[model samples]
Target: MALQARALYDFQSENVGEISVREDEVLTVYSEHDIEGWLEGVNSRGERGLFPASYVQILRAAAGGGAAGEPPASRYANVPSVPPPQPQVAAAGGGGGPGVGSTFCPPPHHLQAAGGGGGGGGGGLVQLTALQHQASGSGGDDDDWDDDWDDNSTVADEPLSGSGSGGGGGMRFSPELDGPGRYRVSTGAGGGRAGAAAASSSAAASSSSSSKSTATVSRNLNRFSTFVKSGGEAFILGEAAGFVKDGDRICVVGGPHGPEWQEDPYPFSCSIDEPTKQTKFKGIKSYISYRLVPSHTQSPVNRRYKHFDWLYGRLVEKFPVISVPHIPEKQATGRFEEDFISKRKKGLILWMNHMTSHPVLARCDAFQHFLTCNDEKAWKQGKRKAERDDMVGGNFFLTLSTPPTPLDLQEVESRVDGFKGFTKRMDESVFQLSHTANEFARKQMVGFKKEYQKVGTSFRLLSQAFEMDQQVFSVGLNRAIAFTGDAYDAIGELFAEQPKQDIDPIVDLLALYQGHLTNFPDIIHVQKGALTKVKESQRHVEEGKMEPQQADGVRERCDTISFATLAEIHHFHTIRVSDFKTQMQHFLQQQIQFYQKVTQKLEEALQKYDGV
Candidate 1:
């Protein structure tokens, strides 16, 4: 855990004990005064040696001037002087011209103009006046910055720190917490997904400019998305419940959203009526048939356990990576056991959850086909239950792990980068969930409520017609359906509790990750600047242009600033990354528990009207 920076070049040692640095390698500076013209450092490989300062550019941002990657210093004409321990600049061969805003001077305007854009003989300075106009935001036209220079080229100077154009004066990006409060930034481009990338980039820039900066977020008022986020989709009763009809595109709603049921929130529950005496025959005993008493349409489908297995198989084939719910273990011997039947019902419910909650697998064509299909012949000819080859093995699924304590910098960075893809998927899932889940839940619940009301009216009419002779059966049936509908209503309430709880944490985490990712690039840039200084010092010593005393003094100061910045960067990043890991684990565990409770509530609800 030493203070470390990335090297920009390869250095060779002429004598033994000299540290040779390789390009793009991260190394730690140990002692500065161990040698003159050469500094002592430890490489990533854990070797200690002396390297000529002229060989590498430091990538960490400096305290006073431009970061290593900032626009060249020549862009600023009247650069202000910065206080002590200025950045070291590598001398270009031929002529040592004006460089480094903190210390190096620029050629006069007359010399720059006469030299025609200041190419050779140390006169390669651009018109500082033009840069001033662009920085002031006064020009109808501005020069496009080029990124063409070889990083090791002797052309001197990084962009001036504290300038209006380039973020300057040694600004650092840090996230600070005030209390137990969560923050989200509103996107300027409304709520479009396209705006997400731009808005995030803008947010990162803004956050880094100050420690108290807030993240920019795209707004999501998507009612359906929010509704499903709360577990409203758990209310879907499947094809047997008569919620879906043929020729419908599968979305979260039980059916399509028309104008009729926009604000309803009643949840769905599917139920099976008691089997008839004829179905109790020895051959049909194993069938254990259940007819879905439709919540919407009257054309309820008859299903048995085998049909569910077929649906499960197709779903696994389609989205193998998604964790499939534990289905009731197949019972070939006790098909008629009461315990077996009850377990099967719960299994079916969990199956629905697995299908609906997943962001990707939830909406697959096979799942839609399973939910809406009612053809008895096809049900009888169910699919094979064997696992698909691709289902169990693929790199597509995210592999998750908890970050270790006390920090391994390389491991931490690697894991963070990996988490980036998964976090992005979470963001997308939340975004999508917010847009459709609420609206779909409301529409379906309202439609079911309205339908239930009609069924109530029909029950009363039928009882009157029968004059109590057959009314008891109708009453029993109506009561069961009512029980199912009531459960839906209660579950809708449960569903609403989740979006705020679940999604807010995700948003917070994304903000954290985005902020961290942003800061990493800045460190590399600053380190490059440090390397540039080392090179300048080395070049001066070798050419005998700088006195021995002056060279020693520059190396000493450079070591202090460089290593100190290195330690600070590592410390800050480690704390934030560790916090990020904790947050991630908390959010994930909460989601798992939330769904488990939801599943239990559903089980209780479904068991209320067994064999009604």
Candidate 2:
């Protein structure tokens, strides 16, 4: 069959610059130079349990730093030398930075003392540094380092050429020898025992307790050199057990300090019991049912966790409960270092949010709210089930054949004004929508006239309205409650209508309200604080420390922040909670009303029939 070639966008790369090519070109697409982006559409469309290849590709692209391509050279003109690549800057290593000291090791003791003497002592075990690991088996960096070549008598696995001067780098392997005798070297291309005499010569053979000489030892090691690299850490279970339950035996391996179960040597297995299971599952996979079985060995649970191996194993009750723990911090270790602790706390926060987000949790919470408030259930179970079914059946994991074009792709020349007017506008639009709303507010606020004379006036009025009727505005609290009551409906609307192109920013804003409003009194409180700050800055102008119109600048700043915060809070309520409630409530009310009217009509018809 003739192969049909296809064209696809090299979205998986960064270096190629945006271009189109035949499908075969993609076969050569390396991890480098691929377009990176969050394939939201693909993820949203695909089933949860089994992500499609396209979904994986999109995720890889997203992880590779998504669509924010390298800035145009002109954009960097005002700034000095091109900012070092992010990873390189991180690699250069510093006291504290995202990727600084990412090498697997423990920091100085003093740094450790600051964090809390020790949380988990083994977490401090250092593994091979990144550079050290990369250097091994790659001929140790220098292209021409052959210290072992001086001894021509030395036999290698490679076939020899000409009278034992057989050293030239190529396919190297050892020929099995038999019997005990010193054999002469054959420099033939097929450097095996060519003649029966050579075969019977029994060279490179050894007696049981012979204490093999240097040459013989080298030959023996080389002959048996079977390189087996340890695969990256992962979980493996022996049997297809049912949901992993507490007290079930399980093993863990491949972590920075050591495997959590730390008993399995390279290629070993063990069972998990209760106490250990409790430790492993704490905040880790609490949402999932699982138990970490006790390990009889103190080493890693997997025997395959040989030297330099990293993995984590746990006895999980179910497949979904298993999780890989990773803390993002400089020089992270199992120890309770400050950064590690901070990250751990952050991880806990994230986990809590995740658990609360579970459908089961949501249903329970919705039920609780309805029972407490004597209101209808906020979430519609049947509708939610349908949505889940659709998600499971439909493919959200479609891979895009093309990638988006960056703003810099068109410009070839270097100049101060390299960017066109529309390009600038478009770039500005990419700035998060909330930021744009804030900018809009700054322009309108009257107090911002001196500071942001260009701002619009509508924003200023909103801020003014907020300040004057704040107590009354407090009534918005009930609206918020109502909105929260209808969260599922709101989420559905947002999920269905959210702009596909720039949804992350919107999603982020929505999340803040879904989780954080309890921390703040109300959106109005945020606005009032901004107003106070603006007034303070205006006081500075009155004191002659600043220009008379500087007060306008402060006001503008206040107006923008206030407006953005309000808009975001309201938008979040509208999308994540209110819409859902409103929709579901309307639906239920309509059904109830319809049934009532139908019963009334039927009764009247029966009466009329009786009279007849």
Candidate 3:
């Protein structure tokens, strides 16, 4: 009987003498090739060539009586000519191949035997038999099976010594091989190496190669590998020569003298209003669009919530150290409801106010684009430009002009630590305040309004009872009682309306600051991480592992992060002070007006009873 094997993976011929084989194709094995990882074979088409031995599983070994052109008994000694194991479906987590489970359901076409249609349909679980050894003279230098197989391919019942490479002297097999043996094969999308039993008999055959393969996979999977692989240009370092332009405005490094701002030459504010329902793709999709009119341009632009969201992301990416306030949250269902729309509109208005007031944020190219670009093409161009900006992250610090004198490193660290502590406490307080104020607003809208209405109802009932009396003296008292009832009803309306003017605005302001507070800690961590690197470099210099000049370069890079962080901290404090003062003043004024209205209504009701 002729020795035959089934191709477990598709093999494209890299060399002229090698034949290409599709996955699941069967080929007749002529003899073991002179090469270490290859085999001489004839495919279904009768085209003779050499193919990788690792890509196929042995279907049948040559008969005991040696025939001409057959591989010697030493190579096929362990490979029995028993019938192929029946296909079995096992659960996915059963111990088996590297990254693949023990059982695999081959496609219907794969289950069909070579020469004729085999039994069983697609998705039938199949247990692959032992893999053949790789021959060296395969005509293709790239046909290294040791590189494809993983080290974790141990048989569940019988453990194998070597990683899944078949380069040892002879084939190895379990003592009780007649049963349903635990053999693993690659069921990956394209094709992979076989399991533990396929490894070389010699334990040390491919140990070094296996380690290299494992390390390559681990390095590729790392999250920071992209930045490392890109030569540190992904975030764009400021020191990266030729990337920074001369005219770019660099942020001034903050020190004991305090932070300085790059004043906006053309300061302006923007108004967001006129929310209207919008549709696209012939109304298949609908959303709300808000009208934005900036004071600088006076050119109104329409934007949806998603546009604002996109701009917010760009701002955060460009200014990692700066606290970019979050926009209103997205809603999936009931988004078109009147109440939700109104609430979201208020949030966007508050968000825009902050964006316009901050000198740095106001001058941001992305913000300007969002506010001023009315043309669709111009808006898209501006968006893409902002996204592709190189001056971001640590590179953003490179854009800053430090003080003429070097900052005291100790003082800078102390100041940063203090600010980090302050942000934590401030965030906690603001969160508590926001929750309390929100709860109070809810009470004013429901609880307080109900209480006032209840009082008015009782007074009106008393007035109605008094009206039933026909005495002349009671008439004046009755009219006064009715007036008092009306006054109470008016007071109830004020109670319901008060929150929107005072408490609600206060809550919105606190919420915005809450977002800023959360962002500060991350910014501080980035600076601290840079500082740690500088210390490590110094230590390396002391140990003779690094040069003094190299340590100085590390310190210089550390300064960039520190400068940006300190400047951002100073800017945050300034904005916080101004914002609180304005909001408190407005809140007090609203409170006074609300109570005054209530007092006047009560006095008018009192005058109706003057005679009585």
Best by lDDT: 3
Please give, for residues 501-580, the per-residue lDDT of candidate 2 as tens digits. Answer: 13322323333333333322332333344355445545655555433222342343333333233333333333346434
Against the reference, the lDDT scores of all candidates come to: 0.35, 0.24, 0.58
What lDDT does candidate 2 reach at residue 79?
A: 26
Assess every candidate by TM-score: 0.27, 0.17, 0.61
Q: What is the descending lDDT order?
A: 3, 1, 2
- Please give the TM-score that candidate 2 achieves against the real structure: 0.17
Error of 3 at 428 (Å): 1.4
Error of 1 at 166 (Å): 36
Give the true-structure RMSD of model 3: 23.5
Write the residue-wise lDDT of candidate 1 on 15-75 in tens digits.
6666677888877654222121244566877777656543444445356653233222221
Name the 10 consecutive residues with the lowest summed lDDT in model 3: 166-175
By lDDT, the better pick of 1 and 2 is: 1
Cα displacement (Å) at residue 310, model 2: 25
